[model samples]
Target: MTAVFAAPAGPTASRRDTSPSAVPRAREFRHTTDRDEAIDVITEVYVPHNLVLPTCAVDMTLAWTPLRHLVLGYLSYGAESYLIAPKLETFYHVNLTIRGRTGSQRGAEEVETGNDVGLVFLPSEPATVHWSEDCMQLAMKIDKDGLEAELARLLNRQVTVPLRFDLALELKKPKVSSFVRALQHLRSELDEPDGIVASPLGVAQLEDTVITSLLLGQPSNYYDELHSSAGSALPRTIAPVVDLMESEPDNPRSLGAYASVAGLSVRALQDTFRRTLEVTPMEYLRGVQFDRVRADLLASDPETTTVTQVMHRWGFTHAGRFSTNYRKRFKELPSETLRCH
Candidate 1:
């Protein structure tokens, strides 16, 4: 019932670690026996409970990796704590419990997450989370613009409405299972010395992969439309347009121009595409362009051909967004593709 889209605000979570010297190379913070310090290091917006240690001193660990449009973090604290945020107005966070348990409430929905469960929080909603003393969580913060762009690409349309999601994720489902596995694998890579995730290519690929997985794996308002075959069964009379999309993907022609080439009224062409391919005419065009970009990346010499040059050639205006969509479709970074070839 609540909307998910939110305007950008100042940073919501604190990236600073409590013990600044423990892990200097990677963003890590460790602190003991200080609740205020913990809350300050966790996020600036939340109200923290259990200021006085219930039994033992506060033991906490926070480590994160910064990417172009996302942040991945591992967090753990040794005492029960309650965090309440009036509103999450900056980004979306997906929390995967690695150990112990977390109980979260948003609106009328409540969910408890453990090792196999995942929880989602949207920016426009208020949330209350209770973490057990032994809880360790992997937190993923996805940039608002980056995620909305991904949703737009997946739906092949302008996102005029907020993309709302179910509060709890069914991690047992096949798609969600695969997503968790990938997340674990990425986390492992990042923790390793000289891991691939340390490279620009790996970061780009993983950022997109995590966002796409969350979008597809979780139940959302647009889920049915994304998986439905309602429009893909259209008449086959529009094959000519498909051919043009494949043949001249970078023709720099507008949708209207493509309709003219197809010898159909603009509205008719749009309808034809929806009915036949289950995607808008422009969606197909963009797919073709993505395919061409992948092909060029595969054929390119990594040393001589940079990702920017190739992306610019294909009319990909924003590097962060382009990488997200590319990784969504290809499951690998453009640079990785080039490296393999």
Candidate 2:
């Protein structure tokens, strides 16, 4: 024989107040300060919580002046109100939950935000946030111009897209996951004392590559008419041709000669150029030469460097054309850049 215990009666049984019942109570840590030094210390401690959700606490500060990128992290007690004011910085933001279940209330909408959830916010936009106990989140601030330029390159058009996430949507797509991982890696490297000094060029390249990948994954609806229209697909062997061009910017091979080396006809090579890069073979070569010239100018020892010496080194047989195009691509003249530095 077994005795039966009655379920908790009326009020408790009928109630739908899950915040208290479903979530365990936890203490919230808040860091509010007007001091820059204190804020920096807090940011250093809190920014790493992006790796996992429901963190114990969150803190962050921006030491990089002009704030090219800003990251924020927050941990909150379950079922508490939080507010964030608008700032003058114009940047895109990505918010991610690393721990504990959480939700955000925006304007007239209240949505459940969790470990797998992420949201993007635009510059100068203000919003309030609330979270349940044990909730942790990472917020990244993206440079506005940098973001726009990246997206434009990917879609090949200008765009002004929205910043909210749909509940039904899976925000942690493969591309998104890769981006988050890359960001964490970059942040870690940047934090190292001698990291920047050791590999500044590599760091810059990685940053550019990550930004390009993210821009490619953005919503298609954000693309403009120019981007919507399909351009000719690049040739399968185009990579080899591009590699050859980069490796030998000073190669004296004619278009026909290069085409023969790549096992393609002159016309076929021209088509590949037009379709893939939207530039002719000769035009691309000129651009490559210019890049090499610029790099040498910036990095070479000035003691042995001269305008003509650098120009000839990059296969600029014609000073007039090189100077003309250099000015066009980089507004302030090559000499000016080299001289100023």
- Writing each residue's lDDT as its tens digit, candidate 1 over 218-303 gives 89887777677652233444666676776777676788887887788899998877765567888777877886787788778888
Off by over 4 Å in 2: 1-61, 65-174, 192-209, 219-240
lDDT of 1 at 276: 51
TM-score, one value per model: 0.62, 0.47
Question: For all the candidates, what are their Cα RMSDs to the real structure?
Answer: 11.0, 12.7
Best by lDDT: 1
Identify the leading candidate in terms of TM-score: 1
lDDT of 2 by residue, 86-154 (tens): 432345556566554555543454566666666655444444455444444554556554565555455
